[model samples]
Target: MGAGMGMASDQQWLQLALTGLMVALLPLSYAWVKGRRDRYRQLVWLTLFLTFDLILFGGFTRLTDSGLGCPDWPGCYGTANPFLAHANIHAAEALMPSGPVTWAKAWIEMIHRYLAMMVGVLIIALMGLAWFKRRELRQSPWPATALFILVCVQGAFGAWTVTLKLQPVIVTLHLLLGLTLLGSLAWLAARSQPAASHDAAANRLSPWIALGIVLLAVQIALGGWVSTNYAVLACTDFPLCNGQLIPTMDFRHGFTLWRALGKTASGALLSHDALVAIHWTHRVFAVVVIAYLSWLGLRARRSLTLTRPALILLALIALQFASGLSNILLQWPLPIAVAHNGGAAALLVTLVFMLTRSGPDTNQKV
Candidate 1:
């Protein structure tokens, strides 16, 4: 065990560097576009697009139980790609054919890492471009810089998710961090586009917009906890949990917030009641979020600048509600579960975009 782990540690850096080099090339080529005056804007939007896909793919990773496929951080058996780890993977699979470390699962895990690295590269490109052309870009580069830092923090959580064996807190935080990155990119992108109006009335809505963001963020975290702990199927029913309105719940354990994966801090496997608590909390919180956001969406529709995102918000909420229901009634189909995650991401981005538009566009000309 010691020798094998030592060898893995030795190869880890080289493999990671190779993976970074390979993934960086694509975004670097895109950013290398010659003489495009508005390339910064282009980069922002493109980064936003990639970040959105990354978040959705992350959900796919978690939902398919592929998080542990590679069973290592940043590589499969200390190799950059699963193909190179074929012997190790095959041996492991041969030992336990129906286990998590299958060929397909390894590929899914590596693809997620590759895509994550690609997104990180794009964020770096965005930060570099913003700084290099700060004067010409006419916008503060702080947001881009902040996003770069957030992605780094996210990368740490990604490592922790694997290192900690998908501990509930680490995995859920990983998901939340990814969504935060998406919202940050969306907010930054809005600055580059022309605002419909930056009038005083629109500015007045900033506080409420920020509040909505906070509420939605808490709601997303609750949802993430449910996903990470595999609690979505806890109730397996809509409007009622386990055929009862409240049911027996163990919030103390469910919301313990720092326990190991599938086990409590006391090293006991989590109980059904604990899972019910998590699922119930997320469901109850959704109602509050939906009601408040609906009102906000209505208020936003009155402002032309906010109208598009307001409409998008309503659509996303409907998608989210329906998808959440589908997961329960349809036995948690992969596509619908992934859609629920994506819908939550879209809702976040739309609201952040609206907030960006309503608030002062610092770079806007007189």
Candidate 2:
């Protein structure tokens, strides 16, 4: 009996060691790829690629209704992967065929989790690279460290989003955090590359471009709030919500961020009017953001590099507007609705890239 217990302990220790090794492998692999190129610019670009993929995968996870698929955190059924939880998932599905907890949903959710972990790994590798090359690379590692910290916080929010049963505030924050991460990575990438000699003309317009980025970020946050609360089709009419320029709205209830997922401050189920309020507020903000960004894009058309990104931003803005309208007119078809979300993300990335690129690089200061 004593020998058997000792053997069991050894096996358990070995299993944990293997798990740690596997987790470590992800960062190692990323570093290996990132180290091959002497140019920090290429490394930054690789991070951007992974970040973009992460945003898209995040959307896919949300659209598939897989947010709460695992019904647990860090793992599915306390296991690292879905395969181990197959029996439990199948049982849950058998019990509720059309319920939130389905095998497919579990797989999707777990896959998202794995992808998120990989991103975290990449960020860690990025920070490590910055640290290792701090002597040669003029860029600071502080930003990379901050990004890694942000992703960790985002991961915590993601877990809460599941454990708390998809709380609206938490979900909205998760979305916003993802975009913030993307923007930060874009800034890092822009800084890594050698900027064309300081153009006084571009420097003159820097403040306005920065303001545009700030406004766009605020608008994106509002949009995230609207999406989190499932208020996209609240009005279902263009130019006016519910056919009125100023539709009846319960601003208090709609903007209450700390309440239950679908409940009001009074503990009553959220009303349609509350959703309309939420959606309408976002719509109004969207108009302001669109007009400002369009003007900025047009103004920046003279710069060769800035021109293409500006045009892409304009095109995505149009696509987002149309997709949003379709969601209302077509009763929120899933494909168009998802595309609308994707378009918002694309617009955010494009604007971030444009603003970063448009800035005069004062390498003299750093």
Top lDDT prediction, candidate number: 1
Q: List model 1 lDDT by residue over 1-366, tens digit each.
A: 999888877787677766776876866677568427678887788879988998999899999988989998778887878888999999999998888789988998888888898888788878888889889877678888899899999999999898888898999889989998898788777767775655666577778888999999999999999999999999888798889998999999999988898888899999999999999999999999999999988888888677778888888888899999999999999999999999999988888877877876634731
Per-candidate TM-score against the hidden true structure = 0.93, 0.88
How far is 64's C-alpha from truth in model 1 (Å)? 0.7
Error of 2 at 97 (Å): 1.8
Note the residue pairs that clash in candidate 2.
none
Clashing pairs counted in every model: 0, 0
What lDDT, from 0 to 1, does candidate 2 have? 0.78
Best by TM-score: 1
Candidate 1 segments whose C-alpha is farther than 4 A from its true place: 1-12, 361-366
Backbone clashes in model 2: 0
Whole-model lDDT per candidate: 0.86, 0.78
